[model samples]
Target chain A: MNRHILSVLVENQSGVLSRISGLFSRRGYNIDSLAVGETEDPTVSRMTIVVQGDDYILEQIKKQLNKLIDVIKIISLAPNVSVFRELVLVKVSATEKNRASITEIVSIFRASIIDVSNSTLTVELTGDQEKIQAFLELMRPYGIKELVRTGLSALQRGDTQISQTVTE
Target chain B: MKAADAIVKCLQKENVEIVFGYPGGAVLPLYESLRSSSIKHILVRQEQAAVHSASGYARSLGRVGVAIGTSGPGATNLITGIATAYMDSIPMVVFTGQVSTELMGRDVFQEVDITGATEPFIKHSYLVKDATQIPRIIKEAFHLASTGRPGPVLIDVPKDVQNDRLDYVYPQDVSIRGYKPTVQGHMGQIKRAIRKLRNSKRPLICVGGGILRSKAQEELANFVTKAKIPVVHTLMGIGALPVDHPYYFGMVGSHGFAHANRAVSQSDLLVVIGARVADRATAGPGLFAKNAEIIHIDIDPAEIGKNLGTLIPTVGDAKNILQQLIKGITSLATDQWVQNLREIKDSQKDVLFEDRVGVNPKVILKTLGGILEDTAIVTADVGQNQIWAARNFPVTGKRQLLTSGGLGTMGYSLPAAVGAKIACPDYQVVAVVGDGGFQMSMFELGTMAQNGLPLVILLFNNSRLGMVRELQNDGYGECFGIDLTGNPDFIKLVGAYGFSGIRVHNDDQFADAMKTGLAATKPFLVECIVDPKESTL
Candidate 1:
């Protein structure tokens, strides 16, 4: 099994997100990461999903998902030809001794400190799955009090946007 | 004039006598108006059950079933039920409440996009923006839901729209652009089909759910007998052809009869009726009717060549198309074909009746057939009971069988039987449900009692979900959540609903119990404690 990045287009409506998620939950399939946002058109929205399954199973899943009324289009992006990233906001407890080291590690991981208090440092990081995993592992030694990660949101390597393919 | 009054008037115009629903803040207006209306409202414990009950009602009643729910969570809860009905092609109208128009995009409390969420599942959907449109939309929703190939429809009315002041003028006609369904078949295609059937040696007839939807039972029977072809039914096609009918060969599916599959594998010409060749029915696309020249007939053009591609597709209702075909058909000598089919039947003789602990499912079905009237509409649930009834119930005369073939939904029988009883009060309505299936829809017993509908429910209490147990035996190696170990006493439950109920523990009591249940002028439940290990299909 491999992680597949599927871009789905659906009508902008309520409970659709819950319904889609409920389907995965009911089917006993674990979702790795999911991100949904409004498209250029207000009526339609795009959702990026990272799920691990066999290619055939994934195809069947996509077909079933496509059968949902709100879902308009679903396209699986090739890993090599796509750029994927996830945003994670982690708040870590920092002492005088670990502050410098944490800042150095954050710079190495291309992360920025979004918020810093006397006792805690909230770092905002954006990277691919592998990079995010590496950063989280490094931050493990330095006490991560809280961490929230957005699922993989991907775009094709080239300038082609999903909107250009179908006008509707 | 008030919107609530308009809603009541709309329901009266549509001829809806009973509706399954739960009260909600957004729908209070309609509910308030319903208090004074002639329509009987069945207040379900949950919104999801309301929709399921409506699905059951539609399948049993042979008309559009109505269900109502509130905004947000209530609407979302109805999604599964609506999808179930849609998948099964059971006609139903689901009414849901929405936040007022002003609160629609403001992220207000209890606001959801019901129309968009339900559009894919329903045959059609409407969002009532103004109260003036309620009457017309309600009329059209029922019309679209019941006509041609049936399916569920949704009408999401905002709180303001439900309470708005508008003159209630029921639409004289429903005229919507891009919504004309074709009713008649092409003469050329009809002639071609007749010519092909006449020329073929190994001919077979495959009827789907469309025959019942179109109420073309007489035409189908006449055509089948005149054509002299063996009939194989999809799960949805059960009861369209009588089980005792000489040419009937049971069902065709993964769980279908061995002889039926062999017939499909061996037949040269296949005449497919209203039902679609679903993946579950065909086993797999690779082994499905590989050699047969399929002549697919359906009212909906999209269903034709959808699953297994059709060779000769005739687009029209089953009755109309069959009537035309009957006129144009030329007689063929298929003595060899008939002999081969009979031989296969003899070779694949099912040993379902040999099992004895309680009454064999096949025997129970046959017994029920003998006891019930010929004009009864039998609604069956999924599981072994469905298979057994499909194999044994010899549907004849005006009687019909209703099932959730496409969805294969459990807990379908009780509510559907209740609905059917309401639709045809004069006709005997029986719901043949397995133990697990009956438990899933047991709440409908109260609804039946409340409405004074004398619906006969036959609960095959095997203590286990027989189909799931079989699946475990075949694949899982263990049956986990398959048993109804602590299930409520169905008879006691019905008694609590103030209806007469009977329990049959032995084979001798089966006929008597059935007679008592049928004789009751009020709703009744007959729980027959059946043998769990028995395989009826």
Candidate 2:
């Protein structure tokens, strides 16, 4: 199995998000992560979706995406050639016993302590999948209370733009 | 300007002459505007017929047909008809009146989320919230439904939205953000396909319904004449060429002819145009044309490599690609291949239909074929009789055969023919239906009677759902739900509705009944007894 991060450009139309997600479920394909936001052009939106499937599954998804009139274009960015990132807010228990250790761990991972309270510390981390996972593992022993991670969004490393050349 | 008036104006801009629809309380404002509009609205007996008639109109006229229905059950009833058009890729624009904007989600009277409900079947759907957006939405709906791989697009206009006033400014040309369809095949792909055809010793052209939809019949004929390839028709593709054309090798697959099936199986190279290689046409990909290098040409890019893989896929409009192919190809001697297939075709003939002890549908179709005009449009229902019509019905010239081929809709014929005759009043229109299938939507006869639309309805009485019985015979060893021995007297049923009709059990009376019916000013119905045991071709 290979991990594919597909950057999809779609028309900013009502119920388009539901339609795309419905397609995944209808085709029996699993979506690991997905993030959608309005692009620079108000009429269009970009979707960053991460999926883990075989080559056949990837091919099927790509073909299905093109079939949706709302979907304009899709670029499957390779991990090695792309810059991938995810924002994660990990709130860990910060009792007197483990306060110092938690701060050291946060500094080591280059994560900022966004919220600090009497009982917990909410660490905001933004990086690739590996960096987010590593930060969460070290904070796990402190009796982590809550966690929320944004779905992956990626861009090509070089200055090869996607917007201007996307339209037919 | 009133939003409802603007909507009508937009339809007029699209050159829609008639609309098959039913007016209800929620849709009063639109009807109020339509009262004075030049666009003729045919009030159908039911919402289902409205859509079916639109489909029949689209099929015969090669134009985007329009259907309208009120919200809730009225809109819900149009689901099957919309789905039928979607499955067949027929171009249609369906407008369903919605509840007032405020009562949309409050579950007020006659409120339904039509856009959400028909998402799968609809090519595109819009829930109109603002009155000002009507012109753009209507224009876009027309553009989407009639372009590329044509299908049904729907717009749900809320009653309150229609009542609201706005300055109507219809766009000069639509500019959809992300919906451009490829209209021309890549030249490289076309060249590659031509090279393959030139090399293959046994080449076959598999024709589908898209040719007729694209108005590519002349180009297909031109291509075939130069290529000298034997063409096989899928059920929906029957009218692509004359049924009696020397190169035409009948329909293919499950109920397909033995020789036609053999022709596909034995061919070394298959050039499939317009036809999606459906399971009914191919049986299964593995067994179907196992040795053939398949070249699939289609207008829909989505359909390419779908269901069955192809060696070379050429995507574009059927007419454009066919025209290109005609210019690129050089005629080769397929004398041996044609001779061999003709021998097999001759040997395999008359095996599917035999003159049985009872009233065989084969003889009925044969006799009917001899009687009907070359320019008569026959709307056929789904049953065992459908297969018989598909095989034996002499589809000649411009007169088309319209059916719920994709949806396999049982009660489709009568209502659709009403739409067809209304659209093309000059042409002779007929509805060929089975007894069990006839009863499903037979009430549409009242609509025909009320409007005084002259139509010839040929009802084949088998006293059962013929296809289901055939399936039961093949798999279960006996029939259950398929049998309907206590069917109502069909002729009397139509007669009570004020139609001049007859019930016949033989050819002589059948001919006389048809002749008399055709001569009448009122809608005519002829019910003929058919053998239930005989298998459909």
Candidate 3:
């Protein structure tokens, strides 16, 4: 299986998201992660979806997504050519003794200490999937109190725009 | 004018003469508005029947059928019908009355998230929030429902929105940014398909419901005649070509004719038009047309390679694609191929069924086909009855065999026949249903009785779900839960709805009974007591 990152542009309409997610579930296609936000045009929304499937499954996914009335366009962003990032907030149980070490690890990973309490330190990290995984592994020794993640959001590195391209 | 009145006005503007619907509390205002309108409303016994009936109307008339229902359970009931229409690509517009805007999402009395529930199946849906936008939404709904890759579209209107007053002016045109459908095939792809067809010694044209949806029957006929190519069809493509046409082979697929499947398997070039090639049509995709180089033609680009690989994917409306193909290609020497197919078809012509106890359904349908007018419409319910009708009924001239081919929903025929008869009052309409399926929608007898339609109900009484029984008997060597031992006396049952019927026990009794039913001035039922041992093959 291969992981595919698809950048989809859709109408900013209510129920469009449900339509996309419902399609995935109904067709038995798995979604690894999905992030949606408004684009330059308020009437349109861009969704960055991460999925795992083979070539046939990937083609089926793209074709099926194109069939949705609200979906305007879809482009698969290649991993090497795209800039992918995910934001994760990890609240670690840090006592005064281990707080200094935790801060040192956080600085090494270039993560920010977003929030701090007597018994916990919340670290905010934004990086690609690999970087996020590495940081989380290093923080595992310090008992994790709470964790949240904004799934993989991606775009091409160059000047090419998805909206301007005509789809088949 | 009230938004409800505007909705009626929009229907009138769309040239909708009738609507199949049931009234409920949430739609009281809309029903009140309809009460004052000239459009005729057929009150179905259930909301499901309304959608099925509308489907029949749409398929028969080549127009978008309209159906209405009130919310929660009523909307939920339309689900099966909507999915059926979606699968078969039938054009229909369905409206459901929602609880007032404030009551929505609150689990109030008679409230459901219908739009969300139907998202996967519906072509497009609108949950009307702005009363002033009612006219535009209605216009767009009709346009979307009837356009490329036709299917059911739903509009859920809140009760308060229907009551809200607004000056409505229906839009003259619709332009949905994300919904433009390709109408013409790419020229380069068409040329590639033509070249492939010319080079192949054994070529076959597999037509589907898209031919009918695009009204490309004439084009298909012309193309086949000029090219001398043999033709086969999917279940939904039954009426695309006359059954008796010289070049037409039977349907292809699992329950399809052995000869037709052979033709598909043997062909070197297979041009599939307007078919998704679903599992039922292909049996299994891996081996289907393995030897053939496939050229998939469909209005929806997504369907081209969904199931099977395509050598040349031509995306466009079937009618337009066929026209393009016809313009580019000349007569081909496929005589040897046609001869081979004919020999194969002839060898499989006399399929012998086991000697059972009662009337043979195959003979009943064949005889009925002979008796009916060339333009007659037959709607077959699911299961054994559907296969029996699809195989035996000779669909000629303008005749149609409407069924829930995609969803295989039982209880479709009776109400669909109602819609067909209403749509084409001059044509003879027949509902071929099995005992189990008949009871599923027999309540529609009241709808037929009230309408005083001159229709025929051909009920095959096997007293069991024969298809499931056959599968059980084949797979597990046993049968269970397939019995309908307490099936009512169907003739007496129809009489309860103020209609007359006749029961026949054997082959000799059917033609006469059918003749009598057709001669009757009101809705009539002809129940043929089929042997429980009868198999679909």
Candidate 3 Cα errors over 4 Å, as ranges: none
Top of the candidates by lDDT: 3
lDDT of 3 at B461: 90
lDDT by residue (A1-168, candidate 2, tens digit) is: 888899999989888998888889878889999999999889889999999898768888887788777888888887777899999998899998889999999999899999989999999999999998888888888988999989999998888777644422
Score residue B150 of candidate 3 by CA lDDT: 93
> How do the residues B136-183 of candidate 3 rate in per-residue lDDT, one tens digit apiece?
888999999999899999999999999999988889989788888999
lDDT of 1 by residue, B189-269 (tens): 998898899888898988878887787777877887887888898878876877778788878988788888889989999
Which runs in model 1 stand beyond 4 Å of their true positions? Answer: A1-168, B105-109, B352-356
lDDT score, candidate 3, position A69: 81
Clashing pairs in 2: none
Please provide TM-scores computed only on chain A for all of the candidate models, following their numbering: 0.92, 0.95, 0.97
Candidate 2 lDDT by residue in tens digits, B167-229: 988899988856778889999999999999999998998888989988998898878888888
DockQ for each numbered candidate: 0.04, 0.54, 0.74
Candidate 3 residue B440 C-alpha distance from true site, Å: 0.3
Quality of candidate 1 docking, DockQ: 0.04
Ranking by TM-score: 3, 2, 1
**lDDT of all the models against the reference?**
0.81, 0.86, 0.93
User: Ten consecutive residues with minimal summed lDDT in candidate 3 chain B?
Assistant: B349-358
Candidate 2 regions exceeding 4 Å error are: A93-95, A116-120, A139-145, A164-168, B349-358
